[model samples]
Target: MDIDAWLWWLIGAAVLGIALVITAMPELGMLAVGAVAAASVSGIFGGGAVLQVVVFAVVSTALIAVVRPVAKRQRTQRPQHATGIDALKGRQAVVLERVDGSGGRIKLAGEVWSARALDPGHAFEVGQEVDVVEIEGATAIVM
Candidate 1:
């Protein structure tokens, strides 16, 4: 009926491992690593329960504070290539309405889109093809 402190740390490590797998949380994995470190302190060094707990706390906090931000930054980095509406630029669209500097309509990417001529004096008649130059909000600037 006398369970060792190292045994408790091992049990905690196992539970934290399960939590990390089930939740897919990096923080839990960090804490689990800390638990293992604490187990080593309790067993290898014959450290007291308080010292084991202190090691666990310090290791876990350091991992969460230092590594988490780097992980998050790497995760949030933008792709090398453009996507979505940005990809529409430099592509071709068919003028559905008379397109002028003011306003018009076009068929782009199988959808109807509001359009404008890139040049102030330029105009595109219906059924003519124009190259998309840019997108400003919901409007496509074409030439």
Candidate 2:
């Protein structure tokens, strides 16, 4: 028995989809979508082989060229949620001890942390609220 051109295109789309799942490469999925478009051209429109090939190539290349950059940009953008020490920065902390530039202590995020004032001349008295500016090697710099 002979398979129709559209059936072959669908098979190709299926193989590409399987490869996408195995390799975790999104480009393969894009190619699979292109193959499905080629199948539509062949089965629905009765297009010639050259037209089907052109549709597949154009669709695949367009997806890679247009979608890949956007995906990469989105992936590379800075995350919204901070974790660990990063989450502590920019938060308010209460001075547990007199905090000067050299050293002190503060209640940060329900835990005591070694802290210092951001400015050498500035100091925070005990029971005062301060803003956590940054974390440096087990120390929180406050302002």
Q: Judged by TM-score, which candidate is best?
A: 2
Clashing pairs in 1: none
Q: Residue-pair clashes per candidate, as listed?
A: 0, 0
Where in model 1 is the C-alpha error above 4 Å? 88-116, 123-132, 135-140
Best by lDDT: 2
lDDT of prediction 1: 0.95
Worst 10 residues of 2 by lDDT: 80-89
* Candidate 1: tens digits of C-alpha lDDT, residues 1-143: 99888888999999999999999999999999899999999989999988999999999999999999999998999887888998899899999999999999999999999999999799999999999999999999999
Cα RMSD (angstroms) for every candidate in the order listed? 4.7, 1.7
Task: Write model 2 residue lDDT over 1-143, tens digit each, in one string.
Answer: 99999999999999999999999999999999999999999999999999999999999999999999999999999888999989998999999999998999999999999999999899999999999999999999999
Give the range of the ten consecutive residues with the poorest summed lDDT in model 1.
78-87
True-vs-predicted CA distance for residue 106, candidate 2, Å: 1.3
Tell how far residue 22 is off in model 1, in angstroms. 3.2
What TM-score would every model get versus the actual structure? 0.59, 0.88
lDDT to native, each model = 0.95, 0.97
